[model samples]
Target: MSNNAIIFISVALILSALSFAMDRQKTIAGFKRGWQMFSRMLLPFLNILIIVSVVLYLISPDDIQHYLGAGSGLLGFAIAAVVGSITLIPAFISYPIAAGLLQQGASYAVVGTFMTTLMMVGVVTLPLEIKYLGRQAAVIRNVLNFFAAIAIGLLIGVIL
Candidate 1:
């Protein structure tokens, strides 16, 4: 695990122990409730992680090169956007993947869109987010994020 992860875990454990010491019954109940909520949130992302792993395994240099190549025009950009939406991997995983793609000759613009929309926009999590936050909120947030992702990609393409 990372140093940050270690520190967070240590701090959380210390705080929980202090709380329990102060009020054992209340602290135990609160901890259990927190754990239940955490598990509920984690369950949904389990499928996304599995599928994204499969995608990473299946994809290769030539495959990324041919369709999402420098010469593929808007079609390539569009494809990258779609792939970014589906493969909802975390940023730590994403950075290395982007680095590998760069080493293997993927365009900077495509990678930029992939990285940005991968974090900012989420088609995979749309149903869950909508269920929790309502349709209007989800639509407005995602629409704005989607447009921003595309603009960022295009701007990078034009500038660099």
Candidate 2:
């Protein structure tokens, strides 16, 4: 395993031990709650992994490069922005997918835009946002985020 992973695990173990020492019952309860949450998320996480793996396999590398590579330019950014805005996928799943896209020859700019929009712009959740935040705030937030994501993607493409 990587050194970072090892260090993280070791630190977690140390902290967990410390917690157990300080409050045994509370530590045990926290562990139980964490395990329950992990178990609940495991199935859906696996399902998403399977679906993403299959999709990645089906799409050709050349196609990815053509659509999302450096040469793709404005069209690529548009595609990435639109799709990213529309998808309601969780960030945890989206990160792996973004890595997969990069591995498949997508441009840094495209991936950056896609990731930014996925996290920032929320077309799918707009109605809910509107309900909670009001129509003006929700719409403005989404619009500003959409533009910011595109600009960031372009900047990443230029810098990288």
Candidate 3:
């Protein structure tokens, strides 16, 4: 595991212990609530993991390089951005995957676009965002984010 992961785990354990010591009942209740929410998300998380695994397994590094490498240019960036916006993989998983792609010859521009869109433009969560934030605001936010991701990717390409 990474040093950051270890640090986070340690912090979480310490905080949990402190909370339990401060109020056992409330701590128990909090744990129960958290577990319930986690359980609710477990299926969707598993589905994303499975899909990522399948994609990685089926698409060879050579193919990824061919399509998303430095030579692929704007087309690769656009494809990565769209894929990232639609997919729901968690950041922890996505970063390592992005790093692997980079190592396998994918361009920094494409990876930057993918990572930016993955975090900023949540196409999968559009329905929920629209429900909570209103349709107009949600659409506007996503549209802006898409363009921003492209710009950021291009900048990274130029700088790096």
Candidate 4:
């Protein structure tokens, strides 16, 4: 594991030990609840992994480079923004996929745009957002976020 992973694991273990020391019953209850949540999520997590794996397998690295690499320019940014806005993968899951895209020759800008929009814009969840925030607010938020994501991507390209 990487140093960061090791550090996080160590910290978590230390915190858990401290919590258990302070309240054994609570710690046990917490563990049980955590395990239950994990079990509930496992199947869907695996399903998403399988689907993403198949999609990645079908799309060649050359195609990824052609569409999202440095030379793809504004077109790549638009594509990433649109797709990211429309898709609804959880943030934690999206990171590994982003790394895979980087490995496959996608530019930092494209990946950055994609990640930003994936998290901030909610085209796929628009109806739900509208229900919660009202149509005008939801639409405005998505529109602003789309532009912000593109700007962030451009900055990432320049900085990285």
Q: 1-160, model 2: which lDDT tens digit per residue?
A: 9999999999999999999999999999999999999999889888988998998899999999999998998999999999999998888889899999999999999999999999999999999999999999999999999999999998998899
> lDDT winner among the candidates?
2
Error of 3 at 119 (Å): 3.1
Candidate lDDT values, in order: 0.79, 0.96, 0.90, 0.94
Between prediction 1 and prediction 4, the one with superior TM-score is: 4
Which regions of candidate 4 deviate over 4 angstroms? none
Worst 10 residues of 4 by lDDT: 44-53
Error (Å) of candidate 4 at residue 20 is: 0.6
Per-candidate Cα RMSD to the true structure, in Å, reads: 5.3, 0.8, 2.8, 1.1
Q: Write the per-residue lDDT of candidate 3 for residues 65-88, one digit (tens) a residue.
A: 989998897789889999999988
lDDT of 4 by residue, 25-101 (tens): 99999999999999988887778778877887899999999999999999999999999999999887788889888
Which residue pairs collide in model 3, if any? Answer: none
Stretches > 4 Å off in candidate 2:
none
In model 2, pairs of residues that clash are none
Per-residue CA lDDT of model 1 for 1-160, tens digit only, reads 9999999999999998999899999998998999998788676566555665566568886877776667667876888777787767877657766776666667788888778888988898999999999989997888788778878888878887
Cα-lDDT of candidate 4 = 0.94
Question: Which of the predicted structures, 3 or 4, would earn the higher lDDT when compared with the native?
Answer: 4
TM-score of each: 0.61, 0.97, 0.78, 0.95
In Å, residue 135's CA in model 2 sits off its true spot by 0.9
Best by TM-score: 2
